[model samples]
Target chain A: MRKAFALIVVLVAIGSAVPVILHWWPMAPDISADGHLIDQQMASTMVEVGSAFLLAQFLLAYFVYRSADRGTHENIRSIPGGVKLAVFVAVAFVGAELLALGMQGQRAWAIQYFSTPDPNAMTIQAQAGQFAYYFRYPGLDGKLGATHPEKINEGDQNFFGLDLEKDVAARDDVVSAELAIPVNRQIRLLLHTKDVGHSFYVPELRVQQDFVPGLDLMVHFTATKVGKYEIVCTQLCGMGHHSMRAYLRVMPQAEFDDWLKQKASEQ
Target chain B: MRFKIACAATMALLVFPSGVWAGTITGKVKVDGPTPKRKVIDMSKEPACAKEYSPTDPPRMESTITGPNNALVDVVVYISAGANDEGVMPSQVVTIDQKGCRYIRHITAIHTNQKIKITNSDPAIHNVHPLAEANREWNQSQTPGAAPLDAKFAEAEFIPVKCNIHPWMHGYIAVLKTNHYSVTDGSGGFSLKDLPPGKYTVTAWHETLGTQTQQVIIGGANETKTISFTFKGKAY
Candidate 1:
């Protein structure tokens, strides 16, 4: 019975690790230039964590099998180097593993958050509200207008609350429901919120940022592939959070230019 | 014979002595001042909607829709006071259709516990967001060809409904305790029927021009009372 029990434990461990070993249900394909670093960091963490889990489970199974007898009183046996060696292994191995992961992970983080965007990067503003996201591009003037909360009226579709009559700079702003960008070009997105907290998340771009109320945030990334991806809100903003989604279309440079020109003309 | 009797009964209810069975209040809403200049909405972001309108005749903001003769449209007139059956819920469903990326009716009124069926008629997806202050606020998304979304408000409050996807699509839903309400038409005409003989207060509400109320007294069931509301407008 003890042998059967240990065999069952071993089988369960193997079964649990099968998915990770076979790479089923992995992260979405990395489409951003800097996403490879994050993928590498994830791989290393998985390796370390997976080994630790397997080792602990195997050791537990072995102990249960060895102590299966209930009738006889046997002297307790310890590992070769006793408690000190166990403590030393835990402190040294686990600590070093964690430190290594942290040190390597910081590079991936810095590349995304610490480094400044290129000077020629296209700048766009993304505003998140209760249940929708709107993207605004500075029109021919290459300047964004000021936003007024009190003047914001969804009825008139003055979503950004720009005073077009008074603010000359706001007259040419091109707002769209979709985020269209040129492939292989760096993008600097300035994020803001109208009412409450919201987040911007694009799995393919490996980008996720929160829009804190009253605080404007910015994130920069470059998409290497030309395709359409869905941008979903991760924050529990309101009743409309679940339905809040927009499309991100990464197009060629010429196509993007034409699209912008067409939008401007429509305005 | 039974069908003939039913038809006769309905006709009798419709065309009886003018005031013997129940009284009705009829009125028109007028703008007291000059109409406000509407701003042209730029729907270029949403090409589907933008294509629906011509460049020469773009869609204009509908905050204040005034018709000929200073007639005020989309004004919700209701019995604010002296309503006897305040808790009676209506059994009929009120529908608000999202067609051409715009709410078909700018203003709609429903009694408490009544169902509101929202249908999306445009090709593009739409999210109906009702920002209710007193009642529970909710947002629902309906894709093209999807089933209509149903909702109900338990409290009496005015809700501003907007489509998050199409920012310009906005409307209002007025949830009232009593079923005695009417929305003015393009000619500013409105009628509230089947009112018991009593003294009541009628209130008219406009999205941008604010609200006005008047005291009315219905003497008998056949009496037809006339009450008019005039709202002051600005040229913003």
Candidate 2:
């Protein structure tokens, strides 16, 4: 019965590792231009972690099988190098793995956050409220208008609270629920929250950032592919958190220009 | 017969000037100055709602609705003081429907602890958010064909409710302690009935034009007192 139990444990361990080893369910495809660096870092971490997990499980199974006693008494013995070797291996392996991961991860993080956006990158502002996201683009003047919280009358669809009648810059701001960008062109996004805390998450772009109530956060990325992707809120802000989502459309330069022109005309 | 005697006694009570009878207060709310033009709402983002309106005719903002002769609509009139029974919640439920991405009633009145049934009648989804200061603030989303959302306010408050998904969709839920309240219709007419004979303060509140209060006295049973409120309007 003990042997059979040991056999079952080994079988279970193997079964669990098979799918992971075969790469059955991989991550969604990377569609961002600079996402390969982050993907590489993720892959390296997965390999290291997967190896450690398999090794630990196999070691556990071996210990269990060896410790199973027979009818006759047998003398117990310590491992070859005893406690010293075990401690040394644990510290050395863990320390090395962490150091490597941290170094590579720092590079990936620097590429996404540390570097400044390109000079010609298109700038847009995204405001997240209770359950919806509104994107604003500067019109002909290329200047964003000032936002007045008190002037925000949603009934008139003055969502950004721009004093268009008073503020010259506000008169040309174009607001939309969908985010449209030119493919292969860098875009810088300024994130603001109208009320409580919320997050902007785009899985395809490998971009996620929280919208702190008082702080203004920014993220920049270039989409390599031209398609429609989903931009969802990750933070639990309010009752409509589950349905808080918008479409991110990446189109060709001419198409994006036409879309912006049409939107501007409506405004 | 016992039935004849009861009927006679009831008839006597109705005929006699009993001090226990309730009265009604009817009034009209009007604006004194020029009314602001309602801005056209751009519902282009919500295609489903935009399709509900003709391309040439879109829904305008209903914040400051005014009719001919400066009659104000969507104004809430309620007894602010001198109520015999305070915090008496009604048994019936008040409903607010979201249709075509707009609140069916611009202003809804309910007593404290009275159940409010919010229904989403449109094909698209909507999030009902009430920004209540005295009462607890809450937000809820309802999808198409989903069950109605139930809510109740614990305190009296003038709460502004809006759909976060459709920012242009806005309404008000006035939670009052007394059941004697009325919302002005298109003709700026409101009637608060079943109000006991007493000296009470009647207040009228508009979403944009602000609020006005007047002290009124109900003389006797079956008496209908009339009152009028005039609010100053802003050009902008």
Candidate 3:
């Protein structure tokens, strides 16, 4: 009987280690924006909860099973401090878990959606269309030029329909097919849409924001990687939704300056 | 004046076939053996799209032009290197209508520099977004009964066109340098006209099934060649 109980303990230990071994395998990793943080939290919680329950249940089962197997005529002797120790340990572990959950939840809530951009930070207006996003820079003057929504025509070179007669700043507007941002800068994006709803998702940097037509949304991110990444539309806008892809150039400050100059010349 | 000249040329070509010294490249894309399995278009994200239409049927959707009967609607048929004029006649205008909230023709072929007149016949406003690497990306909106949106592609590329409002709306614009290419019918058949006698690599391409290249030698003018390409299955 004692040998059988020892075998159960060894079997349980091996079973519990299975999950730990599988974690290192290259599984389907989440590649979406905000995917890293969520994946890490989920994986860690699984390990913590799994280990805690497995250890507690294994001991409890062994004790109950061993006690039952004792001869019917034998009188059972209860350990004096066993119940107290179990209760104390269970409560303390649960309390610790609750505390950790509360702290993590608070941090996630605050960082995910509640924060506002710095007042002096750079702001760019993003307009989501059917198949591509049209980004407009606020020229030398840091204010949006007066736009007449009635006259937006890409064929006639009036894409953002700036009332140049009324707002001189609109005439100097710089627009590009690809988005270029400087690395290590605090950037805020003001997103709006002229047509159907589209989502702006960047997996590597961990940011996904939906562009609502009637309402404008704001997204902020600091580019850490200095390579070109794709800005894919997660939300299906139309038939061309799958092909509605754009390039984002994250470059050093000098190269970004040169690109801006080249775009300015074309505009 | 351009129409009158083209009419006169058509009559002249009909009277004297040997005058042009060009061979007719004709082939049919027969959806043979068994009707190829229809692809299930994933419209899960679009709530307002018409649910009654089975995905197995080509999406009855359009932006500038409607596709040929539900069979691969946006198949781009073009002549890469061919015996044709470098300049396109501006007077030849092909009007692709967006009626019934869809494009009239699913596949449209245009000369590299030729203009395509896109008219929105529906009452609501629609934004035309062309997905193409060959041309500058542009999105423009057209209202009902408004003056047609005349747009042009400066280079040769297969541009997938769509409307932002209708998530199911899809079509393709096959911009070719030569004016000799012709789109296949529902049976997967295509015909290229006015080819000077020479050995040419004839190819058939589908949006779903990739391109199948075949070699053909054309010796006699106005020669008819029967070529067939069968694709196993297409990967999404």
> A73-95, model 3: which lDDT tens digit per residue?
87757756798997998799899
Q: Candidates 1 and 2: which is better by DockQ?
A: 1
Model 2: per-residue Cα lDDT over A94-136, one tens digit each: 9999998999899879877899999999999999987778899
The parts of candidate 1 lying over 4 Å away from their true place are: A61-72, A75-85, A265-267, B1-94, B98-102, B109-159, B162-169, B174-206, B209-236
Per-residue error (Å), model 2, residue B122: 4.2
Alpha carbon lDDT at A128, candidate 1: 92
Which 10-residue span in candidate 3 chain B carries the lowest summed lDDT? B60-69
Candidates 1 and 3, the one with greater DockQ = 1
The worst-scoring run of ten residues by lDDT in candidate 1 chain A lies at A70-79
CAPRI class assigned to model 3 = incorrect
Candidate 1 retains true contacts at a fraction of 0.43
Q: Per-residue lDDT of B1-236 in model 3, one digit per residue for the tens?
A: 54554454445445665337556776655332232222223232332232534544534222111123323333455455433344654458777887654566767888877878999866556778888786998888786679999988888777877777554456678777777677776545577767655556666666545677777655556676766655544211
- The C-alpha stretches of model 3 lying farther than 4 A from their native spots are A1-102, A157-159, B1-236
Tens digits of lDDT, candidate 1, A162-182: 887689888888877789999
